[model samples]
Target: MIFAIVGPSGAGKDTLIRGALAARPDLRLVRRVITRPTESGGEDFDGVTPEEFARRQSLGHFALTWEAHGLSYGIPRDQITGPGDVIFNGSRAALPEAAQVFPGLRAILVTAPDILLAVRLAARGRETAQDIRSRLSRASFEMPAGIAFRTVINDASPEIGIARLLAALQPVRA
Candidate 1:
């Protein structure tokens, strides 16, 4: 089974994934390739130039790809293959397509209140005030129909959020 971690920015998706991985070493993480510089620093992902990204996509190197916030993100086709359960940070808007690509794809929607989201985004220091507002505006996206999903409300501390994620993923563990 593959788990697609989807959520708005600043919802602590990366943090929860890290904590879950620490506790559940058997779960595999798919390192995504993005068109943003590596030093941008939020999640651990490979940064590639747009040309390189397009080239790889043309070569059929990606299992899935989507564009968001003016950046391109891709999950390598090879990474989705293996013996264990896999997980990747994915876009909420791409859930429908993801479900088609990987049958039995379970989505974990990490979320927080708008107020908390604003605070968290501001704290990141990576986006301008206007950019933060832009992100917050599109935060509340409805999950597409016909997809199996679980929600993790990351409204508390990081430890608590991670615990919630672990609990949600418990039943799916192999």
Candidate 2:
């Protein structure tokens, strides 16, 4: 099984994923290869330069790849294989393509209220105030019509978010 964990910037997707993984050790958390610096906090990922990322993609190293915020992100091909369930910090645009690759794929769309999302994005300190505003304006919570997904609102706390994610992933029994 493959589950795509997706949401707007600063929706606490990575934090929620980390907490859920701690409790459910059997689940596989797909490690992404991203162009962002490793020091930029959120999800733990394999950091690579844009050149390297393109090279890897050209070599067919990624099962899925998408570009956002002027950076390239890729999920390694091997990570999504095998019998056990795997979760990726996914992209909304790439979900359609991913669904084609993994038949039993489902999505977990993590979200927060606009105000909370703005605060969270600003708190990250990675993006400037203008950038944060631009993101908040562009990021929509509306999922594609007819796409099968579970929505998790990470508004209250990390614990609540983890519980929601765990419940959504109940199909992936460990």
Candidate 3:
């Protein structure tokens, strides 16, 4: 099955997904495609130039794609086809398109109040304040009121947020 972990930046999306993977080895998380360079100590997609990404997209190499922070991001279709529980960080606006590809995909919206999110983003030191603000404004995380296997969790510490997300997803097991 497919699961998406979505939220504003600094909402602990990566931490939650990592913890869930650790707790559930059966989960095979999808890797994303990115145009930005990966940070020295963070997990991210291998960077590819925009031209290369465009070529691949034209070749139908991505399941879903979006642009953020002046870079292009994509989730490869092959990654989504794998077995076991799957988790991905993605845009909520793209959920419907993803659902078209994987009918049973579920979305978990990880959200926090703006002030906290701002602090968290600042602490990361990876983005300028203006960039963070722009991302926050442009990023989408709204899911329709009612949808199966979909839920929301408030932003807290990584472990805390992840635990909440885990709790939210546990009941949907087949």
lDDT measured at residue 37 in model 2 versus the true structure, 0 to 100: 88
TM-score: model 3 vs. ground truth: 0.86
State, as a TM-score between 0 and 1, how close model 1 is to the true structure: 0.96
lDDT of 2 by residue, 1-174 (tens): 788999899899999999888988777999999998888877789998999999999999998898888999999999887766788899887788888877888999998888998999888789999899888976794666656898898898799889988999887445
What does candidate 1's lDDT look like per residue over 8-125, in tens digits?
9999999999999998888999999999999999989999999999999999999999999999999999999988889999999999999999998889999999999899999989
| Runs with alpha carbons beyond 4 Å of true place in candidate 1 | 172-174
RMSD of 1: 1.7
lDDT of each: 0.93, 0.87, 0.76
Candidates 1 and 3, the one with greater TM-score: 1
- Rank the models by lDDT, top first: 1, 2, 3
* TM-score attained by model 2: 0.94
Residue 79 CA error for candidate 3 (Å)?
A: 1.3
User: Could you tell which candidate, 1 or 3, scores higher by lDDT?
Assistant: 1
Q: After superposition, how far is residue 152 of candidate 3 from its true place, in Å?
A: 3.7
